[model samples]
Target: MKPERARSLQWLLVRRLILLQAGMLLFFIVLLIVVLSVVKPRLMIDNEAAVTAVTGAVDRDKDGKLIVHDTDELTQFRAEHPKVWYIIHDTTGQTARVGMAPPDYDRDLGSLLSSVDHASIGFAGKRDGKEMRPEAFVQKVDTKAGPVQVVTSTFHSRSDSEGFDISITAIVDMARKPDGTADWPRVLPGLLASLGIVLLPIILAMGVTTLVTTPAVVRRSLTGLIGTANQAAHIDFDTRAMQLPVKNVPQEVVPLVNAFNQALSRLAQGIDSHNRFLTDAAHELRTPIAILRTRAELLTDEPETLRLRQDIERLSHLAQQLLDHQSLDRPNEHRRVVDLAEFAGRVAADLAPLAIEAGYDFAFEPPDGKVEVEVNALQIEQLLANIVRNAIEHGGGKGTITVLVDRAGGLEVHDEGPGIPVEEHKNVFEPFYRVHPHSHGAGLGLNLARQIAQLHGGSIAILNGPWQGARVRVHLPLHRQTA
Candidate 1:
């Protein structure tokens, strides 16, 4: 539940989400590319065929005149159109062929007789005459212009046939019309099929991945929430607030959890203060109540009854002191700026008579003019009274009690008594902690003084003085400088 640990978990969750998204994007991109590449070529081929069919008539008209030229010219034109071929034969030696020659004809025009008795025409060669010798041949038709023959030759070319003399064949006749048109309906079906082959699996995978990761993420979130709750559960009322992880948590939950933690902290502080107050209050009242009870019990005897009444009166005064000590623990809102020097002078004058009775010297040395501090006047008076009383009672009844006030708004009460040991310095501020067990007064005096100092945003420290005595330093901020 620590803030740092929560932040780390949140970072991890973010990374996982990023990785999942990236993986999905990468998978889809690859699938799209593959589907498009496969389907694109077939689409291109179909488009090319459709364009060729649409422009076929235009091509035939543009090149029709070249086919009607002289036999030689027609033969030359046919040679240019190597994809088409025609054969012609004549009774005479000369024969004209149109288009490219067949695959097996010789380069030389030998055995010129085309058709003496019979002739054979093939992609490889043309043969004529009684011996059927190879010769330049052409396809002849009996037209209005008499028997016209277009002459052309054939040549050998490399073929897949191994070691055989293979020749090029002009099998496709460009003069012939194409048989069919392109099927446009195939476009949509083909596209859909390609998409299905490629995109469908990818989409399914993404869905599955999302489903799987959802539960994992939810579980992780729940686990983190539970962990935080468990840690909050273990928080001790008197201890400091627990640190909780804040990262990776849902935005909806953070504020509520944080508010709960803050409330718990405040509650713990209130409870600790209450418990300490109760314990100190009880301890402070015990001695006075015991004295009152003992004095009341002594009333059964006649001679000791009057002396016991005096003791009861003194017990009543001590009980009132205990009540005042309890009230000091509860702060009052009334505050004002008062000069420390004047304050110290008044407290010394009031306590001087008591010091004289106890055979102790009391002196008050205030700063020149005024050293103002923001404080509750009554509380400061009570604080000074407690310090003066403790010094007189514990100073061996003869040493001087020096009250020094400074312009810095600091006050020091120095008593010429054996200084407190350094080890007990911190403990002396604790409520009901007494340095001398056999001392007359309850041990709430110094602790109450410290509580008042703290309420005014000040502090008190016990240190060894230049002489063989204990010096109590009270440091309070000036009136204008509130902490």
Candidate 2:
């Protein structure tokens, strides 16, 4: 697979995985909140009933009077502990006695009274009060005298009646404790119990769902990965990307996978075409090299043989350049960090004598400091040689070829040549594309350089240079040193 396409696929997969994890987490949290919210009221009602049952049993005796066997004893007990209040009502639901003024009943006495019934022993009711709503409950009793009801009120130690309300209605009214005063610590245990009850089913459902859906999810993921691999395996080099059918994929990843496959298909075709072109070009160059070698061997010791030798040498050089270019085109070549300034200096130095022989000046101006990048050193050398040679050959031979390296890991080669036409700028980087028909070298120079730059996560571009010269700039990322 092409590196760019592979990277894109990996990125898409990572993004999709993140979104999936987030969605699952959010779904679980919302579900947990909903379960807790729904179960809270029922738990509160159950706890209220339990509290009423326990308190009612303590307030009454077998005879069922507010003062059972010992009235005076009970009163003395009540005086000592005035927080306890009780009332007994008839079966007709009238207030026979008052406990602690039913906390708040002046505004909605009708609603509070209407709710009382034989089955209302543990029912909660609310009444309007001056400051806040007061809540209450009713408890039933069966005494030898008759059926009765008991009510209680919460004591406020900070109020005027020693923080108590001593009215008869207050004495027999149902109690509503102040905020944060009720047995909230008890509610924690209840909440834990409720959570246990609630989570038991959720856990079971999660397990069951995992058991049931996990295989399907895995199957689907495997199917998609397998299908993608299969499609990539069968991809044809000559064709554009085949649009893979992507129906029924997990909604999160469908678009990304589809785009990845499309990109891969395009990349595969590009690399395939490049390989084929390299092969065909190599085959075509072999015949000329062979003929030149044969002709050079035949004219040995003759005066014209020297010229033939030179021609053969030039042909050999071109062939070697072609082979080098082909090798650089392959994507699987190993890469390592190279100092661009140093590499360019060496290349320019090596070619300086050749440039002088050809009546062209060559200069190398490396950056003051080292500029390191990741690339295949030989390929980068070949790239520099091609561009510099092209500059010498086409930039009106006598002009200076200037090689400059910058601290940003950019390399620029400039020469006093007629700038490339804007229209042919893109075409110049295509293999075997040349601007001038009378150009000396083969047209693979820029193409090979661009390929090398791309392999190193860099790029090369041609633009107008200062003083009407052609400038070729190559930019590469800086390399990091590990400790």
Candidate 3:
């Protein structure tokens, strides 16, 4: 089965935060509009705003007469509010009236300008079947030209146009009923435009902020978990003492890490128990196998007796290989520097008799110079013995077995047997894996050799030889190191 595609935790977290922020902002905008719609909305002008608009438009004509000129604010106001009434009265007693109003306000503006500086001018009216009074802002201001009185009034649906907020004008204008009929086509567009004006910049700012900050926050928050995952990648039975650290981990993930640590502890305990059982069994079997070999030797030289002795000997060899393989995992106290060329020559000389007994010629070739290495003497001796035994047992029982050493800290054993198939090269080193399933050898030899070689910081591999045979090479990393 193929694995699922991996999703980035940081990317997922950032998307969630951005979506959460967007949801909140939209909710706030709707809530704001709802609250405003429920309140008593007004779009009235204040005395200060009224005076400033009026003063800017006040100027003298060519004949030196005070007049009111149309400015941008006044032009927009008049265009949207045709029913509005405004009267600009100057110090020269010339009054300019722009829109319709009750006769009382027009008459009072010119004659009562001296007495009234500010007043709420209005008339009695009925709205929503209730009695009400309209309101207009009247104020007098000093300008560059002279003093002028500005009376400004606006009409929407009611007279309660208090100076609380100004956006109410958009709502009123959208449904403006000057002919007692609402302008239905403009309502939706006007509402949408008002909302856009209020929300566009907020959306833009929040989008920028979310993009810039979310990934960094998520990555920093998960630093401890990432580190723990890195440590988990290299875990094995050899590193049973290793533990994952929880420093800077998030509070929510601490329990998960604790559970993982507890599980690892249980696994390490089981592995240790299994290894101890194997070591104990191998040691207990050695003495009985030795006794069995002695008794079997007493009756050998007959055909059936010879077969029995061979079986007993194979069992004894298997038991000893088990002991040797387990011993490689034990702590070493005899590691020292030895000349590999001289060392390989001595071990090969001792194994030559076995080669000759198997009907094969044996030879040892030493390097040109001293090829020294630091290793446990007993372990390397076992590793070399295993490789030579494998060659003698399977070297077609003919041809030559050659051991060669080089100055580069490499030792090779070449035999005139059919070379290992290319596909089985790597699998050959796995424990208990044999090319022929029923072979006499128990198959622990090469695997034990591999383990011992690795314990000394070296590696072993099968290479193609010139004689169409197996060339087994072992490379120790350094020739010699200071003790």
Candidate 4:
């Protein structure tokens, strides 16, 4: 069984699913930003500003050829964009010059410029079927400064001499920021604004829908099984008529439930057969036992005939005890307010003659007023009679046997013979457990009495008596009337 504080499976699954979906969405959002920044470096690069800065720093040489001279303006421009690198090639003079560039940038820029020149298109029309306009685009590339955005604008400058043209190309470098952390405040609002109006509501709706319906769905799925178990709990096996409903029950549980019903059916059949056998056997033997007793009475009034009569009576009493034990197994037929003190006096009166004939003294001490209790009268009578009989038999048939009813609705039968041995106190209440094997009485009397006491929601206990005797106490509840 799970602990009380543990979460159920349905909620655990729903929480995990929602988190997984949200994580995937956030992952893709970061991935898309990285991809866009790399493909179009201008998204993070300010190319127009760098180009104007570079052109303003350019000057004319002695031959009137455009030359990029070292100036404070170029130094300040380099200070502002520390990662920017650039190169300008003069095809007319067959001269090349580098601008405010890193040492690693100077080495790799030549090959890069060569590639840019071949692919670059000038302002002039097609030459050898190739467009001559300058190649102007933005891209991200790896350099000594790490992955930086590069915006290159390539174009031809108009010259005074024919065929003497200068090619100007400017390169600016801006390092790419780490994913998810770069300009997040600015990017997040735009990104969320595009999706927030719709996507957030969609996700929330899905999560709320799952949370609201998950418990109900789980309860609905188990409803049939729960109903079947409750019905089984209240079923009385004696009726043996009810079966668990298979319809609407989960298929996986159907086989086990049906098997349980079948077991109960088999049990009911067995109990019915056993009871029928006990009833038939008791009926068959009762007539012969009565006939024997009558025949013994008809014989001459001698010791042998009297002994025979006593034996028949013992046998008859044993049969009755057996039947009484059997009745305790069935549900009681009626319930009423029984005056326990009056009831104990009546049972003691009926058994007093037997005690006297067996050389024992029998007495009853009932309370002055009625001590009423709600119980089945027949079962209560049987309980009292068995306790009295046990006292008479165990008292060696020569000592005082007393039945007392307390105002608390407790009935106690005690004997002034050899009290039951302390070791045998618990065992003596078990069926067929005799403290003395030679005793003529069947050992089922105490067990039957205990069962009857329990049926009425009471208890019976064997305790040491007040004065050198064993005491059997039956404690039951009393019924009271309100004014």
Highest TM-score model number: 3
Compose the digit string of candidate 1's lDDT tens values, residues 378-462. Answer: 8898888888877876787778889899888789888887777788888877776778887665677788788888878899999
Instruction: Give stretches of model 3 more than 4 Å off.
Output: 1-3, 37-173, 176-189, 331-334, 480-483
Write the candidate numbers in order of decreasing lDDT: 3, 4, 2, 1
| Prediction-by-prediction clash tally | 28, 17, 0, 5
Return whichever of 1 and 4 wins on TM-score: 4
The residue-by-residue lDDT of candidate 3 on 387-416, one tens digit each, is 998887678888899999988888899998
User: Top lDDT: which candidate number?
Assistant: 3
Clashing pairs in 4: 121-132, 121-133, 121-134, 122-132, 122-133
Give the runs in model 2 whose Cα sits over 4 Å from its true position. Answer: 1-318
lDDT of 4: 0.70
* 3 or 4, greater by TM-score: 3
- lDDT by residue (90-128, candidate 4, tens digit) is 333332243333232233334455444223322457655
Evaluated at residue 444, the lDDT of candidate 4 is 88
What's the lDDT for all of these models? 0.62, 0.64, 0.78, 0.70
Tell how far residue 139 is off in model 1, in angstroms: 31
Instruction: Assess candidate 2 and give its TM-score to the true structure.
Output: 0.43
Regions of model 4 farther than 4 Å from truth: 1-250, 480-483
> Please, what are the lDDT tens digits per residue for candidate 2 over residues 1-483?
766633444345545655565567657967877997788643323213422433333334455434333345445545654554444454554443433553333223344554464222222343244333233445455554455554443332224134433222211122235763556554567656765786567655665555566556666666765676677567553234466556645567777877877797768778768777876887788788888788778766877897777667666667767787667545446778777788888888998887888787778888787887877788888888888877877787677778999998889998876777778879999987788876656787888888888778889998653467788999888897610
